[model samples]
Target: MNALKNEADNKKTIAIIQTTRIGDLLQTSHAVKLLKENHPEYRVVLVARKKFATPIMFLLEKVFDKVVTIEHKTAMFGADNVREALSKLKKQLKEINEQNIDVSINLAFSKSATYLHSLIESSNKVGPYFNDLHERVITDRWSQYLYSTVMRGDLNPFNLVDLFSSIIGTTKKLTHLSNKDYSSEKKTNLLIHPFASNEKKMWKANRWVEVIYQTLKKNENVKVYICGSNQDQKSADEILNSELIRPFKDRVNLWIGLDLKELYSKVDSSFLFVGHDSMIGNLLSFKNIKTLTISLGTVRPHETTPYALDNYNLAPKTECAPCFPKDECTEFKCHNDVPYNITHQCIGQLLNNNKINIEELNSSCSSLSLSRVKLYHSDMLDNGDLYIRESLHKDQDAKEVMRNFYHIAWTSIFTEINTSMDIPSFNIQTKAQLSSQSKGIETLYELSEFGKKYSRYIIEEISKNTPSLEEIRKFSAKLDEIDRLSDLVSTSYPLLAPVIDFAKVAKNNLQGNNLVKLSEAAFYTYNEISLMCSVLYEFFEKCSLINKSKPEARENI
Candidate 1:
């Protein structure tokens, strides 16, 4: 014992980053525990997310020395918003660097997390090497290796927990239900977490009502408890209203919005959890419980199912399964496939066996679907097609593509008009106003006018029209003009003069397009023109350049 203690005392400062969600923190805690058990004195710092920080603190006592929490909001829209998030992230990296960490492990699959790893001055950094804008050099195939090691040998990379565990070291130790120190609490037969991190991932409200109804009918004694955050309370209320559940409403208790530790305590007490494919489902896997995860096509049964425990994923195989981080289908065909009947039957099977069949847990059963929108070199792609490649040519082909894209964009604008046309049924505006507004004048329209009256015609026209070859040529010419402008700004501006010189030298060294060089010259000439215009404007503002508020040319009048 003394020898083991002595070896443990020699451990170093290690940082573990899992800045995702509540379930991610719980899943990675196993690795933290493993490290702590092996090296008790190694100072472990957990960089957790703000929402789950409070819940994570309870487990920090023995496994980690410090809990550094970062607040990050997911599912944000717009490039400007994303850029602001990156700025906040840069601030976080500066703060983390103060700790002088020895080794950093990033478990979260975020480009921002990868960027953070690159910014922090750590002795050794390990994480998956994906295409990151921040860390252009540091290479680590940790996620791949992790998947190769921790999962069952025959199956492909599917289970996320096993994939995450693979990054640390290999361990076949069966992950049991979290040992919740619930000596003061009572035990429960079942826990039902119906809510998910996002609205789209949720199974239909009526389907949940039916599942609870069928489960209670099968076993009267089974204690049914609803678990979720505060956001889930409304769904729980709807479930109680179902005719099948009205009699059992009192027995079907609601335990939503409990802090992380409290939620874990509840999870520890329950025998099984009936929920969707969510972070909670993933966390339950580590706790060794029979979980019936209802996956509604946002992800695959194989790639993101519950990790390290006996669980059954109940997502029906569809043409649009595993939509991934983002769904491309405008109709959301993925969610439509998972019906109420399928969910009820899966729960029935789980109730019959009372345990998951490990053999059936393989990846082959998953409906694997990849996202159509992929990020590449700060550019966007549609279903892996490089629609917006780096501007290489000053030719007609590029111009034609741009023009066609603009024409196609009008379809979206027209859809907005079609939606607002129904607003008149609400008695919000009169027919005369709608007709007058429908004339398609925007810049001169009254602020009080409804959008349907003023903009619908123009929107419709844009939707109807297709791009011509000439239009494509004009679009490319505009881009070329912008490039020329940038070159001009670089040449004439004192602050940017060095940049222009460097670009010129680099272009010459690499033998880049001569047309680009000519464009640069034209841009510089335009900058000179702009400067002359500015001087003339200032001159005109003076009394000397004007004849009593009139220009010199109009002085005769």
Candidate 2:
């Protein structure tokens, strides 16, 4: 802490890099604002792409002492245009280096951002950056959490706003920008943004038409505004031309090609904002507008949903939902499953004459099976105000959530261990205990191998039209042995307790003459136990390194 204070005192220029799209850049603003408020002496600087930076230059200038723009689009044009873009980029880099930045924080996790961070001559660097060997190294714990757990795990409950705030050393609620009081405006207007960058994220044009038509029919005075950029004009036209929406054309306004200021003005005056996961939704969130987002396709509501006082998100209840962008899926059930009727109901309630009550809406709509829907609000605590909320799906069984959590946790631990195999040493007693634990993990691995073999044998027996009783008995006995070993290992290392409990539950659930079911269960158990073994192996290996490093410290242990 003293070292950090001395560093901050000596060099006060902090450079924050967020070379991403409009939404992500806007999201990073929370951290920027907090950083400025906390460290008033630190001259905060921003590095962003020119395209996005130009639109929000006014906001950035107000928050940051200086804003540096990178011509990212020109650089990516082609090989022919690369020389000029690189020359310009180099000039900008020289200007930034001249500022003698003390701290450089790369908020965007991209190859370009990492490369840029590596070039900056700063004493301290936070977030992800590339080493000389081109390996990505995340220096901050919060950033590592964002990369490892939040990006992949569905069980993560922290909002990105909270995570960003934490990374920059501020956990308090961010101070909102003062704007026109739009709360008093009548809730009859619905701002609908139907377009997203990804096709998978956009709802069917017909669905938008349905929502528009139903809203107009529900109330005579209700007006629907479809907002988008020039690129989305075609889709906006498709929705406006639909037969259902044609009659309401007089009431519907297509605010297309509006600049950032114009869009902010429209959203500010509007009563309710409804959209997919896109810049408009994020922008509205920045203004603290009441929004309802239909998160689908690759959008993870827990990660990207607009943050506001009472924003609502509707996502599918599928287990495979909120999947990775690279994950191939033929059905894309997330987009198809969101019922239009529910959307209509949500609109009606928001525009109702009575005051908005989020709790009422949540209670009434609980049966929709919207797993990741959450209400964002600030709660004051003794330490500071925080964005308090339950897990993505808090109502699910604790064990079920723990299963997913431990999988991601163990996987992340193993990945880190594999990357840097530097483990400290402990004393003789601790080394013995670690050795015993390693052996137990090896035993679990052996049990998993046997389970896999037994599953294969069961499949072979089914194929041969011969169900052997002796083989079944042997498999059951192996399962009993596995249970005993799991109990011992879990008792030694409490972290493996959940895995043992899950295995026991799964084993107990297997019943009747279900050979195929048994095979599947065996395969699943084998994979899960194998993962646990990997976790243990990495844990003991780290212990071994620790013992090797500090012989005297080991004696105290």
Candidate 3:
């Protein structure tokens, strides 16, 4: 406590580590700004990727006292590159260490970020880091929540900005200059960004044409500025050169390959910003511009939509709306389901002097059989102004959906463990009927015993100077038995069906001759099965103690 006091008295230096892409890095700026705004005495520093940092250095300079760039790509590649990067990294680390940073916060939940967090010396550290044992450790509750339940789970309602704010111990919502404050000149253009990191997130080129054509028809004077990276030029050309849109090319302006400052300038001057889920969308939201974001592919609109009252997100209604990696989509139904007419209507409403009646549009659009589209905007005040709606669907609160998902997941895990403990023991029966009745119980008992035996074998194999292929084959055979038993158990207990899938994935990974990967897979499978058995055993022990205490309870009765 005294040391912390002394550091504070001597003007502490706080470093924030965010080596992620531009969108995520921009989200962290709010937290960084709050840290400086609330504590003028503390020196705030930003450590970011060299490629991503240079483009946003001007904006970063406003919030942070200094910006430190790490050449992560070079540091992680070829031998010559590694040598040069290490030499530069040594000098950078030396300077950072000399600052005697009082607090260090790692905002990225990646392996590289974890390793970097381990290297930084600080009086206090928060977020994920790698331990000496090479294990990943998330030091804060919020970060752990993000990793375990929020990242892949459907029920997380808080936005990444909200999570970032919690990590830095601030409640300040992101504040940016209003569009009016930045640009007093007449806003005559609507900016459109039609590309994302992946094709799945992109609306079809024809859809872009429809939106632009509709917007121009509603207001002929408003010009459309199409914005994107240099890599996106081909796709941008496709949208602009489409036979349907070519006639209106005179009014469309291509703002390709613009730097961040230049892009910000265009966004500020535009009457409305329209795009899919991307960094620029978020950047526009950060600047408090009125934005219309279309959510397609794996984007969870509730989590990633830009933060602003006027910002609206349009998402398709699908069971697998936010599927990740997105490589599995043979037909991207989610993207196809979003009607371009809805986007056209949204743009028309924003550009029109009088707001279009939403109820009338909803009634009219309902007849078109377009997949149900919902508009979402930030609502909750405490959660860094979290996004919310009356309902994602009829009678379903979006927040409650996420909460219920978490509830069901935890309940399923607990039920499996508790049920495994209460399973009755089966004695061998000579009668066919009795044996048939006990089949499910017998299978579960066999699986439990096999799990223990397999775990012990793995331990023994790992202890050997060099375990032979024969031993590995034996372990694989045991895994096969577990899979068979799991299938039989799932017939009676449907909840245990995932166990079969888990075993199959482990087995598939073990097939290749990579000894290191095989060993890790074996250890991981063994540990998982062992944990299930251990929990069941603990429950069994507790049941025995309760039965033993029954005599005392009977006497009292």
Candidate 4:
């Protein structure tokens, strides 16, 4: 037992910790199934919160060999029952530790999850865990990438499912939910989950009224089913009270009473699920039910769109969209941005065969309506990971343009999996933004070079016959100044936020403990950052110069 303590390579058991909500668990399930399929020898264990895990234990039981749950509410018994809670937590951790876990991955980046991770005995760890000094540390590259880019902003290009797959050290295989035959069914039931966990992500009931009315009016044999939690009774009343829905009252079914498992079982392929960015949509996606997600404030569609083929997503073109939760919002102009007509059209098309009429929708919809929203159809890549393609690219914005580059950059930089990533065609405004942002890239390069210089100095000093600790500390302090200066560059050019964010994570999760080893690790990180700068600079320059009469500019970047 003593010799095998740190033998991570010998063990085949891996523990995945996902203590978040239902949607996150669904996404994790999608990624892990691929890992299980490819390496059936590995025994997968799960660590999740009791509250979240209880809802979907029926599904979790099939995927994982052992499921250990943390009783969060019990653990927070305040001053009254703290000892009892502590005893339970210790028992839970001891149970997990005895499983002989080789790898313990914390996909849920909550503070509680990090605390739990520190106690679990794993030969190797991935994702965030508090070290002995009580400082949060994430050693793996993919987890570091996730920590840096996700939740920061619209800068993240890859979907959550894709990122999870990357972190699990396995690519998602091209195994989608099996195709279900819905043609035999005469009536097509459309499941609409209009409410989200947060208010910012959902549309008002009145707007949904227009959508339901139009959908029932234009399409025959189509029923609209509404589902939400019991807490959403008041909001559901608002939607149900609409006069527009009066004629189609017979077709609209509200099944708020059904638990998650019941809802999952009841909704089949014949039912098309349309809603805001919510768990109902994500849960249904596992069964390969078609989903139409309308992402609003604080929801980045690129990251959280339903995981499957032929699904759809709609998000506003509002500049402050996918805004931070802390931001002020008197009126959700982003909600108003998606007109009912566009949504009705989308529902009709997908109802037919789970395909959006890109050309027809673009040619038919009013220019004013087109100007308000951006439409994307979700599809998976060769490796079975999901991606969304803009169906209507007539008004592709600058932010979308940069997202494309970073999609290529991040995938290549982290995974070393180079894509045949093409350069996006730019509009006048995008070209202007690109030109200005390139200068920020220059500043980034300068800062990165200085970082490399300091790292080198630290390494050189540590290599001396009689190394001076004070001299080494001075060089390390200079590197800290350089890292601080990098924030300024991102401030001036928000487009370079991902670049700065990634570098910060890379430096924080540096390899080695001693000054000699640590200094060399810092040098390699800065060196990599410098290389990333070169790649991004080349992309920016190529974009600006693409207008020239050169065929080479048209080639894959």
Candidate 5:
């Protein structure tokens, strides 16, 4: 054991854990590069999900000593599945243990993160908690987690490359560490990531239409390159087919489904990146290239916005606010309403500003705080003044109320489709189905007169005595405290601790609910509630049977 320990102490072993989606994996890859560059001698290993392993593995092949792939989903879900995943993880742990890993950085923040510390056998485990997040010196922004050294804020927003580099202690600059070297080429083509992950996040097609028109009108020598995943080919094709955009088709090149390295090479060569708040925009910042990103909703530029070398972000003010899981609006009015002229004017200004050296332009990126934004409130609730006034006397009826509840549920389910699929490109049938189902629920809600009347009755009865959201939260926390106390009491008895613990868990989940990610809290609470309800119902039924049997015995007496 002394010899083994001595051998482990001789080498500096670092393990990076970021087993999430493709975008997150890519972001953490830059950190690996920075680590290798800074220390050069330390042995580094990256733990990635199977799906994200391929592209990032290929990118970081030469940077790290080894790439470790984990079955990300199995480890993420339940305790049993996590145990099973850990069994496989033990082998890697045994290997890294032999080397005595000095540092472990977790890029993901989930319930399963604790498992990584034990499996890796590392002394230093740093990551984001609800507290103790990191701050990047270059970007001057607090990173999402403790070990996350990557500074990604409004002024230094990044794609995966820049994010990774920041964490590893590099200057605030984007560098594409590709296998292929292109030292002699001049980039005449501009890469455009016009589509976003969601239609609501995408700049209007007309905006793209104008960008292409103006880009060609000014720099006739410059070519346009439209980029996306294979799933996005249809949208790209539609854009290509448009007569307005088609005139420049000869000068345009659509490169979807290219290999990751090839795409990076292309993006590296491009003069500018113009897109919405997609991963592509973030990726562009890594290359240290000029870019223009259009943002919408309550997505604070400081928190989630991209970092462009020489560019600007144009987001308009709206009444609905950053109603992120918005259902009331039939169409996404946020993205639809950003003025096209504003985009064109911004692009024109940057093009004229391109006379400066690229290095100076890169350093000139500015940070816009949530408070500094004058045109719009950080939250859309500020614009609630625009909403139609409501009176206390009016209330929705039962049928209408049922319809509204149904609509909220259906919309929530449809939203789940996007999250569940995790496809980067536009999925036609699924997208259409989501839209249709949501609209269908809305139509039902509007037509259900009986639901509306019954709902009104319930509302009238509850309105005079209803608790505010804050009160509900406090009450839920108090319930959790009571359950915790009950657990302490039951532990002494030992027989009822399981039931107490179960109640404690249910109450705790209710108190820490996140309204944005409704599925996480709602699903957990509903399951716990169902179990408790079933237990109580069974207990009552047994008691009623016992009482009837006693009465029968008394009759016999």
Candidate 6:
């Protein structure tokens, strides 16, 4: 299952193990491009699932010097006996092992991938891999950030590509698209993919039918390409055969059951792309083609939106949106939360190569209608990473303001970068919320000081000739209480929970061989949180200087 393109002539190889779905494979490409660009002499290899990598061979061939794929289903199920299967797997792995991989990075976040990471032969390993205790351990800061913030909840501020590039040790956070692909040479074709990985993540065919019917009617020069896989043939037919779409038969192209490379060609011929939260949106991202993603069900628009500039995302403001897969929901209300009218409006603007403006959207959409969904555009963050910036919201609310504070705290603590301060105008309610945050921050900061004090006590006692175990235990118990109290503070504020959780995880994964070294590591852990709290407290102090005005509530970031 090891598919080698042009061989690397005795160059050091860097293997990227990303054994996930098609979307993740596409996400990995962004980082691979940066790695190769930074170290062109180093041969970059990709370790992906056989099924996911094969379909995108046309794309992967251009990015990776060599692709090592895992065909576990064939090796396990195709074999006649257990011994034969074992032989088959070992044969595939032996080829991978012989590559003498200089660095093996695991972008795939799974137990199986973690186990596989341990098997790869490399002088250095990054991302998560199994330790001697068979427990998953991540040592790199970026991977640790991914484990703490991203793997836990939707509050993570960085895009997946940004995290991947950081994990690969790349210096710049560059966008993948060049101006050459986004030129006016493209035809007036629009690519629309309505299918998702599961029913929970997409809308019904009738909803897309209405959007397509309106789009074709408004733009007579544009043709629509309904894009999907072979499995979506039945669903694609339902949209194409709708009575509303019958009049636009000449303007519509049904692209299904074709090679993935063929789909890339279709993208070249298209001027814009509109789709649900699916792989096609990620695939279309390689090009700068304007995209409008209607994220429904469990999709966190901020996390999964295409990592290209000028991309737009629309998700329901529904409280239950971006729910977990395990949550039982027969209602599927998030789908209905986004009306098709706004979708068509955004497409109309993007198709004409018009930048979406707040006034432009306000001219056509109602306030109540707009309130149900939020429109965001992919823009560069202060650290050069990609993030969803609110395009239509008019002001920063309490939650948005808190997110900005956390952004500063995380940016200050994890990286050496300092973020530009963004002081949002506050309403009376938001001012009250800020007052609450001030209290919460003070409490949390005090608790972090206690953590540092306890760890310092342990370090001090350990330095003595006759260290009392009871005193060490007493301080340790006090430190444990401080952590529990910090967790309780998050329940009141809710916004500060992620950092506290991350601090806990870091303490649990503290490195060192003995108590002295371990206690120092623990002290560093608390010191970082203490620094984060200090940074946040400075922001609140800065906010105190912003002129507070009483006015009608407005939305913005």
By TM-score, the best candidate is 4
Q: Could you tell me the lDDT of residue 413 within candidate 5?
A: 27
Local accuracy of candidate 2 as per-residue lDDT tens digits, 280-304: 7767766777777887877766566
Candidate 3 Cα outliers beyond 4 Å, as residue runs: 1-7, 76-85, 173-187, 353-357, 367-371, 382-384, 390-394, 397-400, 403-557
Arranged by TM-score, best first: 4, 6, 3, 2, 1, 5
- Residue lDDT tens for model 3, 1-557: 11113343577887889999888887788656655555567787788888988887778888788888886566656337667768766776776677678888888878888788888998877777776767676545455456644554455655677667666665343443233433434447799999888888887778898889888877788899998889989989998888878888899999999988888865653467889855787777667777778888878776777755545778877667778773588788887777888778867766663233566567657644433666665444432335445322333423333232233232234223111111223222212222232333334545645654664666567678997768867876776677676667756643233333434343443422455555555555544544443433343344231221111101110
Cα deviation in Å at residue 16, candidate 2? 0.9
TM-score of predicted model 4?
0.92
Q: After superposing candidate 5, which stretches have Cα over 4 Å from the reference?
A: 1-11, 32-42, 74-99, 128-187, 268-270, 297-300, 304-311, 317-331, 355-557
For residues 506-529, what per-residue lDDT tens digits would candidate 6 score against the true structure?
Answer: 887777889988888888888887
**What local distance difference test score does each model get?**
0.47, 0.64, 0.63, 0.78, 0.45, 0.78
TM-scores, all candidates, are 0.52, 0.67, 0.69, 0.92, 0.50, 0.91
Comparing candidate 2 with candidate 6, which one achieves the higher lDDT?
A: 6
lDDT of 5 by residue, 1-557 (tens): 00012134366677777777665665565556555555555677777666767765556576568777766355444337766776666655565566556766555655454455445666655443222232111111112212221221111112344334433334322233331332233446677777766665676666687778777776677788888888889888877777787777889889877766677766654466666654565455456555666666544342333432233455544445444534355576666556554455445445544322323422333222211221211110121101111111123222212222222222222122111111112234323422233222222222222222322333343355663556445434543443444445444533222333333333333322244233233334333323332332232234231121111001110
Q: How far is 373's C-alpha from truth in model 6 (Å)?
A: 1.6
Candidate 1 residue pairs in clash (backbone atoms < 3 Å):
146-166, 158-302, 176-287, 177-287, 177-288, 437-453, 437-454, 438-453, 488-523, 488-524
- Global Cα lDDT for candidate 5: 0.45
Per-residue lDDT, model 2, residue 421, is: 20
Model 4: per-residue lDDT, tens digit, 1-557? 11112333553888999999878987888777767776666788998888888998888888788888777667667326778777777787888888888888889999989988888898788889999889899887778888888856677878887788788877444465444543434338888888887778888888888898888998878988899889888888778778888877888888876788898889876888888855777787767777788888888888888876667888898878989889989898898888889998988888875677777888778989987888887765554556677767754567787777777777777767766445677688877877777667777777777777778878888788998889988887888888888988889999889889888888887879687788788888877777777787777667663232311111111
Worst 10 residues of 6 by lDDT: 548-557
lDDT of 5 at 347: 56
